[model samples]
Target: MEKFRIPAMRYRGLVEALQAEEIDFIDEAKEFYPLELVPSLEMTPYPHQSEALVAWKLAGRQGVVVLPTAAGKTYLAQMAIQSTPRTTLIVVPTLDLMHQWYAHLVAAFPDAEVGLLGGGSRDQTPILVATYDSAAIHAEALGNKYALLIFDECHHLPTDFNRVIAEYAIAPYRLGLSATPERTDGKHADLNILIGREVYRKRAEDLAGKALAEHEIVQIKVKLSQLERERYNQLIQTRNDFLKQNRISLGSLQGWQMFVQMSARSQAGRRAMLAHREAKEIALGTDGKLRILVDLLAEHFPARILIFTADNATVYRISQELLIPAITHQTPVKERHEILTKFKEGKYNTLVASNVLNEGVDVPAASIAIILSGTGSTREYIQRLGRVLRKGNVENKQAILYEVIAEDTTEERTSARRRGDNSPQEEKHKSGKLKVIYGTGKKQDLKAAEQLEINYSTQNKDVTNGVTDSSPKRRRNHPQET
Candidate 1:
């Protein structure tokens, strides 16, 4: 009888509550927009994609879709757009992904005016895309502008600020997309209230050789130089001593933050913090890892590769030493685009980056990924693995991810912590098909190095049969020298 407005984020819950009370209400929030005739799809959907669409529709057109990267999640979103054919807003995490969504929407709906709300553009068409930052800032204004809201990288939606964007939006139809939906903060549980439940799920292994590339993960352990090891031990001793004296335990998320805050308050704490940083740096950025990287590059010569490091400093160091392009948060937008474009076009065989390439950005499919160092976050590890798991040009071509960890240091624990129980290595080992190669440069380890070399060389041998190659490679003399 009377018209009132409620926050769009609470649309589902409010409607349910009103219905339970047997109240009659008309939803006038969704305004109908004119639909423009769009061109036909350029490519057909895979069977799994169709299944995902059906699953989402069955879920009342609202829920998250878990699909691995390079599995055409964007195209699936496009299909949803066609099926719904309503005013839609696509929210993305980064400016790069914002532009990407804008381009894909433009191409998918040529007749429809595609608008951008980030990267300095403010056009508001029927089909619009906005960065999470822009969407969060303009959430109240954009509350009722769209009937359907598609959150790309929806795992980001649960954060305090970003969650507001979803809460303020009045979209009746919502879809969240992510390769990994679990958040380190355990905030992903908020997705059920914020967006919807996950209706469709797929992992890299679940789609491997069908939707994704056949892949293997190799963990290589290398020792730090003797002098480097000494420095690393000393730094660890200082940090450990400080932690023990202060009775600080970094086992939980809050505990770590407490440690960080306490470390900033006193001289001893500051020294301990610096020592922690220096120790980690030495372990993650050791010359041994660099030497192993050089060997891996030579072994996988001419194959496209991506090198990931924990920080921009290491990224730049590797880039300068190996003469490869580096991408970091500090890289100019234009330069970043050029670097990625060239890499996609095969102009650069290898590219190194820090955390920038972990998500959002559509990096070219590389045959190999060399992760020099990273955090203990499973999400980060999965993202890095997904970077190289895209299907390659050649059939049966396996994507290889080499995780180089500094042996006898904190990095070993870091690697184990990141892998968790869901690691590809565990799955492969379960199937008795794990292809691991350890290279510590010891005389006795030469056989393992040769076996690794042989495995790489013969990866293409069984391509025609659609069978995965598991034969061990011959050992090389002085394999550490490459």
Candidate 2:
């Protein structure tokens, strides 16, 4: 008799191959053990979650489940764990999610030993939750430890660095979860092999009234100041001239990449890049958007509001100007936690953040979301909208997302792109809970002594019903709490 050693990750595949060839072999690579695990509390799965669980089971317990955020994906994961009572390893994208999953497991499976494998702690319990970075770094050691693997925010697994975590795991059963599974780089196709094919999926709109709060996405177009518009046009003209001289077409597939590569080598290209950036900044950070924001705050005051911006500069600006609690990536963990705690407890009525709260973090129920600015990614739009779709204490809560864009600038196209429109014209009569309203004139009365009247009466009759005058006294009397 002859024997050959193999990598632990190849255990399942090698066994299947050998079985296919009708060859006899001794197996000893698996180190995972099955156990009897039970939940400490009773939970009834929503119809979608139960259907997702069934679909996953029918797919041989190896596949991805696509559910909108706040649609009870975590509960489905718990059910999967109970069904497959094997040593399990859950890999999350962030330390915050690592802690969240750890807490959920500890409470759900009180009899089973659960442990953390990230954030400066390492334990070898039956149930382990680890961050992607830690799991990938320690892949070799943990190759055969778990029989089941669950990847949260699984869209991140296809990255060059993170894919190795799945490649090195010998787990016989795998589950991937994400709100949006498609990747911009097209690496999401790799999920078909990394985790099994997607077995279940439900769009955010599909579960709006049932699983998520009924929501309306409102688009408001505001004009730039005369001087700002002049500067923005001049910068765009400079950038366009450079692009023309270099024969670069941003409309082409590789045009942007080519521009990036060409821009790093010459002063003219650098100037073009800077001009483009300045134009974009002007469009994204116009003061007119701020005026609209002030009105929204006054209209929806004391409602748990989440204000999103594309840059930290605007986040800090709004925070300093309006005295709202701001959370950026630079915010310290303890401070961020405290702010969110206050927000949850109603000590703070509003929070301003720059992309950090787009996904993963456990944000309390916020019925109103004001998007000052953001990129043209549908995933980002969905995540931002999801922040407010979780039903709160208010009955028949209708989540409202106000997207403020700079009219006549590139932002109009960006806004349309994110909303799945090919061009600005296509978004004019877009239906199904989406209403577009354009500013009638320029905002000339932004001075402190003037009342910023957001009169939507001339535009949409429906919008005018909610629009109101923001008296200077009331606008200046905003909360000064952090």
Candidate 3:
């Protein structure tokens, strides 16, 4: 009896309406889908996200948007697609991330048909989500239709990756998204043009305590047990006595540096260090992890948790021992989805994962993150922590980060990774002395990736004021752009 005026450009429940007519929608999506499209992911652009959208529209072309992971960077892409309603090509890094982006975009635009171009090419909806490899390989087929390009993990746009971007269907508009705009091999300038440098960056620290929940960064030190302590003491004594007999003091510069130098120069020194570290891990890290998990369970009982590890075998081993299933790349798709769904639904209290699942996915249920090992990248460290901080439960007061580092070895020294360029006034570090792997910053906030340029055929975007844009025009394809 009542007919209400509804806005044509913006219609509510459009996705709901289309999904209700599943068969009709699928046929419509496959056959002659209407020109007007609607997205699935429901979101009102955050103030900052809106800012990024404005800058992208203002640039009138291609560029990257650098924003913290949880700061709704994915949402930025959603808005960008709406702003530029062209056949859009989205490139992500991994399968899990592909699913994550797929889930996100579907929620963002319910009325629009979406396609997966990676291993499984299901729905070739106007909005296509594919891995970087697949996107690059099929660029030619997609060239004519694709007018808008969106790269999720832009930093990986380097030597091998520049191709996917290069052959992109000459999409007039491109958007690169990443956390940091820094580069390791002096490629920051190139990235300036590669994905549009420093377009709009919002730091984790800014969002951590407010936009996100407050957090406590805890480093758990698992000391050796009595038996292990005895073994460690014996080894230390052997090394100490040998060094003493040789008049080698471990405190001075020559002596201290010499210790590490000896580790490199002498096999015996390396053996001694390795044995010592073994005792330390057994005494502290591994056992402590078990204990801490129990302890955390009691306090934050029934809460969702993400356990991250650098070692895959160890992850599976620990998962088995703990009776919790471990998720890896080898995991079957159906099983992996089941695991994630169960965890998300609170059926499983804790989930163990490798670095593969760390970068992507939205585990709104995970309020706690237990880091077992890492390569000292603050960016990854922080990113892992961000996993738990996404808006969640009422009782979940703050995010928790538990780091287990084996003390008295290189592992111990680098456990608290030095992220960012900031460091206290200290000693000299020779570049070639050791394999230097730097942290992106916080364990939860991985440091920005090293820079690589976006080789577009058109003129470069400006990065002087911390922004850039490639004017929307057709130019000769550069062998380097993907």
Candidate 4:
């Protein structure tokens, strides 16, 4: 069956708002808490945060919070929950995130029951966290059970099946959260009607060393090995010829996927694909990021590490080769729980996986995350980074990230798809043309630089309501402890 598009009337109205540069939405029903009593606790907020709370209240305290990943978005939800003080259903993207949100709210409001509804729905509590799948498919069963709705990672709520929750529920208070509000296909008008608009947003550079966590993105370029290089040249030629011959944008109409699929159809295609794929593989393999992981593990042996990959095959190959426990859709419930339990208990120092762990999941802050592969989804990349940014105990502030990239191929060309800025591919290797993108922003490429230099690190020592000491610390390990 063909997929149903969004409602044209509502979508067009939202487009008109953007066209006129404004914000509009259905007002959230607010009763228990008015604009004056919205904030739950006192934590120093940045200027934008204070402005956001005020705007949320002014806009009837409804809709989404579009802050960057490390920007304390959960804190906003907590304030909303505290002020509202009614039965609330917190909808999230995945089971892992469901667990994380449950933990956060439970810690904030210790007396409240933070119910869960994915992987397994728990007993009803005043507060609940459910997955998008559960909220959509089972809202009727839940039966108007919530007074307020909180949608985390809500940009993905546009699916018709998923929109059933909005259709069935009568909650007047709505809260949508994400690091971004933009969609790859420019289809976020659906969210505009259901939730709200870009109520608040901050950039990584804007928050650096100020309101948000200090972050630095060091892009490395990984060149292919000799065996792989020979094949890569031919693949690049074919890719070049295909785009040039067809005269089309490489990212348009499944251009990237088609290019990759064509490269893997036969012996010649396989050779080219290998060149491209192996180039990325070699980059991750040789990069200093791995060595950095070893160093980090040696220092923080009990740390939890979550590695993200774009390719499932790459994830499988990594798990098999490294002998690390891996999780996929195929990984059974019991097995996933066992693996995650072992990981949480510090039984395993490392985990290699794919997109499954990116958005949802309460990965520990003491651990570091490695991005072995990914495309240009800004939201996914930021969320993958967030899974590791939790405040840690003793050695909690060790949140780190490493990105590996294949040099001089599509990997090099993938940077051009930024929020409003043109990605690197927009100029380089576009429509059969080879040209460098002249831009004010920097071009970041992946390399197997030093064996695995940590791309990012944070001292996650600070925690607000619970967890972590007020200050950062470096705690040495005990040999007797596992």
Candidate 1 stretches greater than 4 Å from native: 1-5, 10-28, 34-37, 422-482
TM-score winner between 1 and 3, please give it.
1
Instruction: Provide TM-scores for the models.
Output: 0.83, 0.85, 0.68, 0.66
TM-score, predicted candidate 1 vs. hidden true structure: 0.83
Sort by TM-score, top down from the best: 2, 1, 3, 4
Ranking by lDDT: 2, 1, 3, 4
The model with the greater lDDT, 1 or 3, is 1
lDDT of each: 0.76, 0.79, 0.60, 0.58
Give per-candidate clash totals.
Answer: 6, 0, 52, 28
Give the least accurate 10-residue stretch of model 3, judged by summed lDDT.
462-471
Q: In candidate 2, residue 269 scores what lDDT?
A: 93
* Candidate 3, 1-482: lDDT as tens digits: 98444322111134234333432221111111113446555566666676566555544445677676677878788777765555677888787788778887777777777779887674567888988878777755665455567888776665455554643333446788877545445454565554444445565555655445666667665655667567767776767764665577854458756666676667777775576556444533456566766687678777778888776776787787888878877888899889989998889989888876667777877778887776656567657877877765545357777776554444454454434324322232211211111122222211111011222222233111111121122112222221
* Candidate 2 per-residue C-alpha lDDT over 310-366 given as tens digits, one digit per residue, 9 for 90 to 100: 999999999999999999999999999999999988899999999999988776468
Candidate 4 CA-lDDT value: 0.58
TM-score of 3: 0.68
Q: State the lDDT of candidate 4 residue by residue for 295-375, as single tens digits.
A: 545665555667777767767766775677898877887898888788877788788777777655655542467675677
